[model samples]
Target: MARVPTDSPARRPFMTAVKVMLYAALLGLIGLAVAVSITYSQLPSYQTLTKTNDLGQTIRMRAANGQVLVSMGPSVGKWIPYDRIPQAMRSAMIAVEDKRFRSHIGVDPIGIARSAKVRLETGRFSQGGSTITQQLARNIFLTNSRTFGRKIKEAVVALALELKFSKNQILELYLNRVYFGGGAYGIDAASTRFFGHGAERLSLGEAAIIAGLVKAPSNYSPTADVEAARGRSSVVLQSMVNNGFVSADVAAGVSPAEVKIQKMTRQNNVRYFTDWALPQLDTLIDETSEPIDVWTTLDPTMQVAADQAIGRNTPGGAQGALVALDRDGAVRAMVGGRDYVDSIYNRSTQAQRQPGSAFKLFVYLAALESGMKPTDTLVDEPVTINGWSPRNSTRTNLGPVSLREAFARSINTISAKIGQQLGFSTIADMARRFGITGEISTYPSMVLGTSDVRLIDMTRAFASVSNRGVAVMPYGIRKVVSANGRVLYQHDAAEERVLVAPWVAAEMTDLLQSAVLTGTGRAAQIGRPVAGKTGTTSSNKDGWFIGFSSGITTGVWMGRDDARAIAGLQGGTAPARAFHDFMVKAVANRPVEQFETQVPMPDWQLEPGEEAWGAGDNAVEPVLDENGQPFDQDPYVYNPDATAPAPPDPNQQPPSQLPEVSVPPVRQQQPTDPSRRPAPAGSEPADDPSQSGADLAQ
Candidate 1:
């Protein structure tokens, strides 16, 4: 047996140390190789800004005279030169984002070690060792996946960024790419959004507040929580002083008073207009793929006036929409809703509700075209046809009234009768021709506005009437310009003659004047001549007022979002009041002009078998027979003849009768009780048959 000699304990220790050193060296080589491979493969060879989609990114709305109403961008980031950035702002950013920004080469080894130790000790991700360049890399080129793979890629990209771009370039890109609260994406926009000023005008405290938002914008938003934002900003200021970026004395002496928050004058002020014009612009630009500038007829003064008017007049639960157009159909002012930020439903162009008696203007126009004069007599009686009976809004009839009286009174029965007599199809055609782009029901009830119409459509229709029956397509943009200031496209006014006769339109306008003077539309009357109609639906579900003056045609609609009736609101109240308020302020500086008056009716008289006829035979003839019923005779056969021969004389027939006839004494028929007669044969008995029979017997 042979015994093997065991190695000494000292020798064993030396060998173990050598083996440990070898393993460490090998591991270091492997890590170095992996790092090199990742840096080479993951780093982008070339980086560029995301291609701008002008349609989705930027929009411009202009006035008729080529003035900008709004300039909007989805990315609210604006680039500024490094020199323009305040020294204090740069220092604050450095102190909060990266303390060793100037000395680091895109990667801070010490920061990484400290962050790793803290992460391991805390057992949560409490620290990020990303340099400014690394943050820029993640924002520009990498996704916000927050995974180990993404972090590794970010590190590689950060190293590449340092190698490719200068420190100032990296800082500029980072500043421009960060997000701030309130839809602001960069320092420039944040400055403008919060302070109502540009980044270059930022003070030390203001800069600190903006820079502090970079970490958690919503949590530290000045608009959302001033106290939390101030605390965060103070931390940034202290950090700047600690890092020697700002003097300790300056940091200590600064008070909250030194940080002036510029008042937000129009918080989400342009939101309504932007929401309305965006879809239209998208449709126009995206459809043709043609760059076009829409020169709107928007007058900022009028828009503000309209917004304020609607805000003031609409009830707490109610929202209102308004649209104003020029005689040429150019939109001068628009308020889509009460607050666009709260709700995006554009009531002016999107909501559809019954226009009520505001639709009577079309009915009256049809009647006028059918030889019915505005002064002609019309019975405002309860009318029943085919089981459909319409009653007056007042629940009582005004017997033997003139057409103008019926219209001014907004008698539902008269309007319904007129609509039925003219044919619902004819009225629908007229409405369509007048630029009403809604589904119109061809029912007898449609005469009293039993259909829904958008405010924009109504505004265009009224504008057509104001433009002497020349219908102009309503448009917002007039011209589009490229990013480099090149004219891309321009919009031309499209006009068409929609009414049968200009005179007919003029008479209709005159009739509408009575609406403002004494009818339901009285609330819309301004000092100048104004023509308008008021509308209140069956259950008061909708309130609408549409009118026009010399300078603008305005339409207002008031209602609740849930289709519920607003308390005490009618077309003549809130909507009309809002319209008047806006119009008065909007046209305050414009010269007053009188509405065109209708021509006088000519002298004419009712002949045999003809109902009561007025002098204005040339204007409009009564289409009624001697029995006060709708004329059933063909218009071609009975062309109105002022001079017709009388029948032969009865005396000439007396020579033919030779025999004298003995006449029996005629018995006088006993007068029957007036209330005992039965009602007309086919007539459906009213709800109270006895009362109906009595009235008919009378």
Candidate 2:
């Protein structure tokens, strides 16, 4: 082997192996160059697209009167110039997030190597080596998948960002794109949340505290754990000292005691009102396929007053709702419940219960349309109909009373009688015409509020009456505007005629005014003329006091969700008290007004032994023959005097000899039943012939 030939057969194999190794090295270098060229050619032009074309950013927003009602996600951060950020905050963010942020070209090789070493030692990936530019790239353009493919995409996007934007621009983007806890998505929001100021106004210590929260937001949340937050903040301060961002003397003097972590209060201002009003706005604007800012008619002062009144006057475990609408049915204020956060139920619009005596407005209207005058006499005695006897809430009869007095007192018996006299179908028709969508039964018991009606409908009905019988649909929003300040939708009061006569409306208002002045609605009496009614359902299960002035109409309700009776609660006590307390402040500086006046009544005189009926009958009439003619028979005779003789009971007579009368004429005599007679006027016998003759002979 010492003098081996250059072309020996045994050495030929070794020479061939060395030639093969050289050729493989040359081919590998050529393939690497081609791969690099291909990869560079495939890189996307992300630098040309400053904004991504993604649909994930679309948000549904609701606003009222140009003010935000609710935002589903964090607000988008407004871009600030790099100089607007405080130097201390900027340096602190760099020290904690990316120490070589300014020096790196989007990727930090030293950070990656150190993180890889730490991961290897810990046998798990605990630390991330993403530079600030890389984080901005990922947040703005890349998916959040923790895989090699996504990491590659993030790296490519970061490199593209560095090539397109300057160092200051990249830093500003990173500062605005980061997430801080408590619904904050940028440094500006974080600054305001932590110190109640802007990011540019943050002190060095406050800036460090906010910067420290990026590592673990929940652990360092000033709201969740104050002590842990202080510890984390101290570490950030030490980092600032170590990096020469802050002086050693300054860092030492900055004690944890000096760190003022302001406790965030739950934003209780109009949270519930905004929640309830947003869906309404959505319905009003969704058809246009545009974003809208709803301008409502709500007065903030009235809303606050209503809320305070409900909170103070309502009993424990008892919830209350109040709605105040202007004369045009524009909702001025609404209190859904005590705490909307605790219960999302909007009792003012959602809850439906028997309106109790408050429903008598429709009944009285029916009576008025049936030609019953407000001064007409009605007996408030215990009456039975088809084995169903309705008793007044007072449990005692006031004997004979005028329609005005009976209505003012909200007597159940009189209401039932009037409803029956006018026909239950007529009352049901009236309720329907008044925009009451609740199911109303034909039964006489419905006169006493056996029908369930929502507070919204009831308030709207009252608003109609306050508007002088012009029924207007209740609406919360006045107009909706787009983000660019264009009108997308509008709402105005739509009116319709529901009452037959303006005089009837005036009479009803008079009766309700009597209720506020001298009846159960005394608590709701204001300095001005107010017409209202107090209603309590059976067993006090529901309490309601709905009233109105010339300017506003308010309705209040108090009850439990379970329909359980609140002990010692009534409309006049809690609901009326709340209404009064609220309206006192709500109507402040508003002019006083009087309700419309009643129609004049004609004066008339009756002779001795003569009884004047309510425009229906003068006396009881006898039955008639079936041939459509009156008969001279004993049982078929007409009697005008009660002392003359007692009329034979028609049911006891034989069928063949029984007399028949016209249905319309017979309806008049039914009101003269001995059990349903009105009390004598001035203590004189109204129908007795013997007593009348004695008074006349005197």
Candidate 3:
């Protein structure tokens, strides 16, 4: 009775279970093989991982003087080799993320168990269990998707990386490619973005804060909330202490206030210019793995001045944009809005708003091109074409006026008549030749700027005139250099494009100068020989002022994004005033420039031809109010006690030749080099922030 038979019922049941398990194992292997076959093309090649591990090139946009305007791309600030990466930054990351990083092959079972236990005790996940190598594998060759297949890929890739690379190489890869926060990918960029310096200079406390951000970048972003970020930093420091990376006293020595949080708004404003400039890179160079330096035409001084002008002078609730271009078409300063934070939709480049009177420049240029002189007699009377009638703001037209006088006065009837005579297609072609882009519709009322245009295009068109009729396409990039400072592409300014005859620009200048001196653009006069035109559309939905002096052309536009009317807003008030303010600061340090040998302002048109060309009772247009609407009564009368400068005396004669603008008292700033910048508080001498972009070029 003691011996059990080998083929008993219990043994048979065990054998059946073994067969079922074998079949399940076979099916699982078959399923895995099928999965591999289906997804092989999408999966990264593990053997090629080492060769393709080059970190993403960080695109650093810098002003002319090398002040970094903004940075974008896969990686942050700069690439740091494992050796150059500050010891504290590496230590803090290891202590907080994977204490057993040195001993683990690819995964850390001990760390995972610790994390799971802590989760059970706290009823919440308190720590990450993935080793630094696993993270590097995910960052380098895998997506962040959470799935069984993705996890398997991460593990397999991590093992392959550990086999091919050392602990330091894995750490360096992780540090350089990890996403920190706020558009920053690596330590270098995150450090500069948050602390205004490079990662190499991070202090103990700063390193701790950066290490803490991996868990929740947005929540711990110092820019968004400093106190919360400081709390996270403390936790990182305490973890470092527990892991023996730092002593308890040394950990406590790091102060919370030592973390200086720079506001992102001020620095982020330049993104408007960078955003406009970045897309142009696609046309300039093909995408490459090596980093590149985009040396833009941005002048730091001019940029600051332009920003101040728009911020201070733009009418509240109405947005304003400014674009300044050198005669050669290099963009000096671009402020795309009153505040970029309020709107990222670039008003200078993206917004296709009605140019209003600004488009009149195109009309006048076409008029001059068509053999019409500034002195040609043009009647400022009512005119209608295709049942479309044009009337001046005064609603009454002058009996007879010189082309110069009509232009200066911004008389609507004369421009409409000229557009009809010149043909809308002629004006449209003229605009295109002057580098105006996008659809410039050949509508009857296009002469008065009914067709929409970008401020940059308008500015570029004006720049052609400023360049003595030589054509210019407004450009922001001056040169794109390699990370090693090798020039990739440079703008060939010598390849001149003559859009208009020199004589035509001269005639246009004379008319534009008189407009500032004795017509609608009176507010634009800044004690300089300014030449500009004022544009105001029906219902005053948009206002624009574009002009050029000292070989630098600037255009300003004011309007709402919704195309709603800004009460009384006109080119002569806020837009012109902003232009005046920017110019006052922009050209303060540059030498005064001559307008070439141009024709004189017309005094005979006022007196000698008084009978034929009516001696208008109003020599200059009335001063517009804040919203740019005309004053009912002539209110520009001289007031000695006025805080504002009194209006020019109508009885007094203007000079035969326009005078060059006198320099103001403002001081120009040298281009900033962050490498030369004094080390900020709690920072050390490491890689220069200015050189970070160049350093990461590879």
Candidate 4:
């Protein structure tokens, strides 16, 4: 070939190429310098990888005595210091990820060139060529996008990290802050999550397996794919031997199969209570960044008893809920459902079901407030209003009964009459004032609990009666403190007067006691002078029994979500049995206390044809009308043997010609309805008719 002249066309192109190459190299060096300076200037000051009391951490709940109830957070594991990490894990990680980890400043130029060559030849970017320091930089400060600008920035940031921190510091940060999959955030968490032990106690095989996970944690997780994880660990061991971290003999001898993986066992029933209390945390805690210790008012003993009670009495396929509160309205225990695992819906505070007769307490409270004495008498005959005729569960009338007796029998007619006399609006308003925020019907049947209300609200309302008329807002958290023992929040119960008069509550309590002693709630009596009411909804859908002693107020409910009537279930039966069992255990250690003495009052105002009677010679005189006969005692009577008496139809009788009569002394009588008799053990009635007298609530 002819020699080309240095200044010829071909020679000029070659010289141009050489000059271009040199200029490009110079420009690259200048760009790298600028990038390094910028990345170094942007680096953060030294900060520990593990944050203690970081408000950003998960919330923690504890009992009143400082026992941990639950810790709610993304990172639930403890932080382990760098020195505590095992040497085997460190060697395994360094060998598998970057053999030149200690020797390289931050970016490994030789490895980068090799990775770049491989990518070009294979048409794939499988080789990352990332040193431990570069990975630490990307994990803490950079994003994982494969772009020229990001890579440049990553290189610069990695250099900055290497300059600012020692190799050991960089490695320490890498192992302590990297994600190990399965919500395990650090080496300690990863060790425990995979091996069921601490990082400091990891074996050689365990260390190799964990180190293998760094490349692709989800795919290499031993818990998820054992064979794949073992294969990756085998690769890691070979890499360790190649890097001189371990001898080939030692690497070959190590077996990933021998690594014992632990199954996570976190069976906690308190999650239900914690979930219920979560909303309160935002208002109760202003600083959630640092770990806060919430001190709640849960009585562990009462909680256990409540759990066991529901489990024992609740039949299969039937769901139940229970709530217990102290005299001051502190929620001692709450069972939202039969099993929280099956469902997280908290029935106690969230579910709104018809309270049935349980809501009658508010009605009687209204009646008591209206000067209706418990001893006042009313006819339990069927009454109709606007065409809604409420019937007694017995389908027959109790000729005459005392207000106290009527309540004990849960006579549907009497409650409907009382609700009519008071007016539905009056009863609805009174129920609202008592903390029942659920929608209440204004119909006459409202007295029979036609409105749906939450169990917590009912418990709160009854607790107000137990608290001597002072309204109570149910609270679980007693106090909140920081991890460093600084007081963050404290509960100071605000005083409230829900009832108009304290005496009204006392009188109502007396009436409730009478119900428990000889009325529908007789099955709920625990022999220590108890008071409460029984409620059953229409169609036997829901049953409830709420009662309270001098110190604790409890409410129990049993039903199915499908609104299917549980076979043979009644408010005064299964629910009452649960209440008795729970209360028996809850108050076993507490001293028995007497209720406040109820002050006596004069007779209540009478309705039409109603009168007060005295047993002694001090009886009042009889009042007579223009005619010489007693009212409701006139000679004209409806004989059952004949067809039902036809009223001189309103259209036939002249208003002025209606017969006038004289009233005579009325005598007290026992209820003729057999269902009015107190229910015996195992003979409880359904909330629907034919169950029992108290079953008429709905």
Choose the strongest candidate by lDDT.
Answer: 4
Question: Could you give candidate 2's per-residue lDDT for residues 1-698 as a string of tens digits?
Answer: 58889899989999999999999999976864564455445545534332323212223333334455545445434545589989988998888888888899888999999889988999977989889888887876676778988786677767766776788878876676676765566788777777777887878888888888887876786656767777887888888888878898998887766778776665443555555666675476655434445677777778789989999988889889999888777777788889764665788888888787788889887887677766567887888766677765445576877676677666777887987677888988988888899788777677767678888788887777777677867677777676688887788546466555566777777777766654567677556777888777766677888988757889999989998878766677788889889998988878767566454333443445553232334443444667767534222112222132133455874343222222122222224223322111111111111211121122
- For residue 521, give model 4's deviation from the true position in Å: 1.5
Per-residue C-alpha lDDT of model 4 across residues 1-698, encoded as one tens digit per residue: 98878899878988999999999999998988787877777776667444523213656788756678877664435665567778888899998998898888899998899899999999998888888888887877777888898787788888888888888778877887777765576788888887787788988888888889989987887655777888899998998888888898888788878777786554455666777876797787674567777888888888888988888998678889999999877888889998775566788888888888788888888898997766578887868877677776666676678777777767778888888898989989989988999788886767778777899999988888888788978899888888798998898978666674777887788777766765667678675868888888766678898989858999998888877767767788888889999999889888877776354333463334444543345443443455864444311111223232122454664443222222122334333444354544322332343322232333
Name the best candidate (by TM-score): 4
lDDT values for all models: 0.70, 0.70, 0.74, 0.76
- After superposition, which runs of candidate 3 have C-alpha atoms over 4 Å from their true positions? 1-54, 71-268, 597-698
Please provide, for model 1 over 1-698, each residue's C-alpha lDDT reduced to its tens digit, 9 standing for 90 to 100: 85534476757877899899999999976875577566657554333442223213455666656666666554564677778788888889999989998898778998899899999999877888888888877776667787999887787777766766678877876776677776677788889888888888888888889999988887887766677778899999999989998798998877744576654445444455556665676555544333345566577788889889999999788889998888776777778788765555678888887777788778887888787765667776778755677765445565666676567667777876887787988988888888788888886667767778888998888887777677767776666676667666566656466665676777777777756654567677677778888877745667788998865899999888887766666778788889889999877888887666454333353444443333344333435555766554322111222222222355766333222211111112122333212122111111111121122222
How does residue 532 of candidate 2 score in lDDT?
82
Error of 1 at 620 (Å): 8.8
| TM-score per candidate, chains pooled | 0.55, 0.54, 0.58, 0.60
TM-score of 2: 0.54
Decide which is better by lDDT, 2 or 4: 4
Compare candidates 2 and 3 on lDDT and give the better one: 3
- Relative to the true structure, candidate 2 has a C-alpha RMSD (angstroms) of 18.2
Query: What is the TM-score (0 to 1) of candidate 1?
Result: 0.55
Clashing residue pairs in candidate 2 are: 65-294, 65-295
